[model samples]
Target chain A: MIEVEQLSKVYGSTAAIQEVTFAVEPGEILGFLGPNGAGKTTTMRILTGYLPATSGTAKIAGFDVHENSMAVRQRIGYLPETPPLYPDMTVEGFLHFVARIKGVVAGDRAKQVENALTRCNLLEKRQVLIRKLSKGFKQRVGIAQAIVHDPPVIILDEPTVGLDPRQIIDVRNLIKSLAGDHTIILSTHILPEVSMTCSRVAIINRGRVVATNTPEQLMAELAGETGYELEVEGDIALAQARLAALPGVKTVEPIVDSVEGSGEPSRQKLRLSLVTGTDPGREIAAVVVNSGLGLYEMRRTRVSLEKVFLELTTEEKAIDPETMAAAYERASHRDTEPPILPISVTTDQTTDWAPDRTQSIKSDETPIEDETEASITAEQPSRPEEEP
Target chain B: MQSVQILFANLMAIYRRELQSYFASPFAYVIAGVFWLLSGFFFVAILLGPEGLIAQANFRDQLGMTNPPIDVAAQFVSFFLGTLSSLALFILPVLSMGLYAEERKRGTLELLATSPLTNWIVALGKLLGALTFFVTLLLPMLIYQTIALSAANPPAPFTGLLLGHLGLILLAAAVLSLGMFVSSLTDSTILAAILTFALVLFLWVVDLVGNSLVGPVGAGLKHISLIRNYTNFAQGVFDSSSLVVFLSYVMLGLFLTAQSIEAFRFQRS
Candidate 1:
């Protein structure tokens, strides 16, 4: 129902989005997945005819967005990030006003407004002024206004940003039900929303589409190697050697096991992770049994959609050590130093928290790279910061 | 014909919404109340105070001097219309400041820009909405005129009163349209109000600058001066050129406002 090609928007010298290309089939929901400042809203704005692209073209129902904007707008419904509401207007009044401007026929206006109110579960609050409603209800009213005219395409920007978990689920289900009648392009930074709600996911980073596929396809394509975690009571060195000696085994690493409080000395478990190109669960189990090691448990792990998203979005150019050191210095100076405790008093607590802290820091570095790279590129033209 | 009908439908939709929003807020009531109070005070004090125009005319009659008729109706209506014109310089900016500025601040401009309605329709709707409310504010002043004229020996000329009001409405339409243009340029209503007041005040006094200049330059400045054109109408004279000038100002303001909104839409896109 929507086609966008080579869509570029440049404000002065800085490009808000460059050469963005995507399509949504009729009755399909496409999740525009990206972190903040990833140009998702810019693309949606262009597609909905809310903005004009500096170059390239967008079409809805075969009408060019720029040249035939009225026709394109007639076919599309847009809910901007802020919901575009008048606080003094009641929910029903606001919907009626939107319907009139959206060109719903006068005879059907009441029916259409009622339908929207019911769809958004806003019937009870139809008479209440929008300013008196809670945030979640206001968001529902926003969605109601967009859908009141029954447009064929709906563009929503971060439809569930501030909602509680239950409200999020309710909104997700509402969006799911909207499919098959309306083509949806929803942009959000939240990862699982895409996995759960979208028929297809497009991952954008640095104003570029890095990956586009179904959630399952993305996970499968990135899940090239399999891993297994095993808990066993044995001579650690012998088990490591045997696991590494297996044909498909790539690497073997022992994990720090918290088996201190176990009563049985024979059950002093050692946890190990085995990375292999193929399943090594069976081979490792046989090896552990034949080698006289106690095998307590084994499980296989596959790549998740979150990992695929991270890998695609975090493929940043390596930073030089000087810049890294400067960044670290800036960070440490900004954060207060921990109080100096006696060596013995701090040793055990430090050891317990050190691994988790390092792991978290390592995880945080990827997104920070994406953010800094985006900001540096955006600021290169020395323009005022434009919110996406 | 079909396109025109669609355009009218769109315009009415926007016009109704804007008009409804005005009544929905307390700002409109406060503005109207202050306007009525001030205009009512000027009307009563200038024409009916203890040392007023009628009282001085009575004193002249008591002195046994045969002075020709003072034309009390003409004098009072002229002065009353002038007061309204000057008051509009301040009242209009307050009324028109929120026409587009508040919509921009609240993000509703996005909805309007992306909708199927043309920029001209939106601008015209808002202008008409503000103009209609301004007319309502002028209604109570007519009651004051009725009471004052009933007590006078020679009543006001009904044609002159109607003609003067027509001039007031035209002048107001011109000023409100320009104020709407200024409102479209900013997101802050206060800034819109201040800028509009400055622009209107400049045009209101531009004839003074014209007085110092000589020859055709002075004539041209006098011709374009808003107050100069309005003064002819205040005197119950229907000069065709003055009508043309006020109409041109209204059209110019409307055209500029439409263009401003279109430019803003492009910049956002």
Candidate 2:
């Protein structure tokens, strides 16, 4: 339903979105996740034909954004970060207006507006001035306007922003319900919304798509090398050395295990992150048994999307927000170290919060590389992004 | 057929909303009332004051002023129209506080930009909507002349009256469009209003300053003189060339409005 090919948008000397390329199929809900200021909104704007890309092409329903904007617009519905609503107009009046503007005919305009209002659960707020409505209601009105004409392609930017917990749930459920009826591409700072509402996830950072796959697929791809976290009763260094010597064990790290109580004779419990190309639980148990160490707890390390995302997007040494650009100059040295590829971005964690589209797992990536890299690299992983 | 239908739909949505806003606020009535009061004072000044000047010139004297054989009422309307045209520059920025600006301020303009309607179409509809309100305010004054004539002996020259009204409205519309263009430049209403008024006032006096110059430069200034063109129309002369000038001004305002909307797309990227 949507195709963005090497789409680039630039302002003066700065590039907002560079070489952004992605595609969404019909009836698919593609969550565009990114940190704030990531080019998610810019990409959506280009696809919706709101802005022309500086380079490359974006198409909706086979119509070019720049060349066939009129046709492209007609087939697509877009809800921007700020709902384009006239506060002076009432809910009913605004939707009716949007319906007309979206090309709903005079004969059925009222019905179309009514249907949209109903779908957004805004029937009672029809007579209320948009400015008078609460933020959530105003958002509902925004959604009403987008879907009033019932366009096949829907592009929503941060649909759940500024909502309280309940409202967030309500909007999320509403988005999920919209599946199959519309091809939805939504950009948001919220992570769980993608896992819950989007069928496929595209993580974008710094204007590039860094990852894309189903939520489950992403979790599995991130956890490609099966391994376990083993805590053993022995000297931390001894446990680490023992785990590192096991055959088929790709790598091992003695992660610091903090215990609340002290002054006891209890031996240190070393948190071991062991890399095995296959199931290594039995082999690890044999190693611990022969090493005369008491096996504390041994369990598989489950990698969640949260870990994958943070691991994928963190910039190791970000320029201090203080010195601004000057600090960025110093931050460049820290930019190169991370647990993942794009090894040189130690200082550019700026896009970690924004969906780094470039983080999408390559279908052709070697499984061996995925495991050995993430396991050994997690020891010196970059700090997780600060929540907004 | 579908796209055209969509364009028409969007235009009318903006049109109705704009027209409704004009009537909903006191802006139209307030501007017209103040203008009418000011025009009445100017009319009284030119007709009935200063007998010395009239006697010296062998002209008529009514109240305290000397008067040329100028249709004093038309001259009064013309002078007020000039000032009122300038008023549009002020009133419009406040009135057009929404077009693109409010949408931007509220983030709705992005939705509009992304909507099915083209940017130019949205802009033109909005421009026409604001000007329509301006025209509505002028209509009451147009009717005022009819009542004034009902009490007179020789009736008002119908053609000259129309020509004056047309010129007055076109000038006001042009001023409003220019103001709307300025309004589109920023999300700040106060800034738009102030800038628009400044530009209108500046352009209004551009001709006067230009004409007073020593030589050939003054001739060029006359071409840009907003007041000069209106003066000819107020005297009941309809010059197609001057009409073109005002038309060009309106077009220029619309073009700028369109460009500003498009520029946002780039900045956003």
Cα lDDT, all candidates: 0.75, 0.67
Tell me the lDDT of candidate 2.
0.67
Clashing pairs in 1: none
Q: For model 1, what is the alpha-carbon lDDT of residue A65?
A: 93
Model 1 TM-score is 0.79
lDDT of 2 by residue, B1-269 (tens): 97576667778887887777566556556866775676555434443446422233334444434433445455545555555555555565566665556667877777677667777787778888877876776676667665654544445556766787788777776777787788788888778778877787777788878867868888777776666777677768999988998888888888988888787666754
Candidate 1 is graded, for docking, as: medium
Backbone clashes (count) for model 1: 0
Return the top candidate by lDDT: 1
What C-alpha lDDT, on a 0 to 100 scale, does residue A308 get in candidate 1? 27
Candidates, DockQ? 0.62, 0.61
lDDT of 1 by residue, B190-269 (tens): 99999999998988888899999999988788888889888888888998898898888888888998898878866873
Runs of candidate 1 with Cα error greater than 4 angstroms are A222-277, A280-388, B150-152
How well does candidate 2 score on lDDT at residue A132?
Answer: 93
Per-prediction TM-score to the true structure, in the order listed: 0.79, 0.78
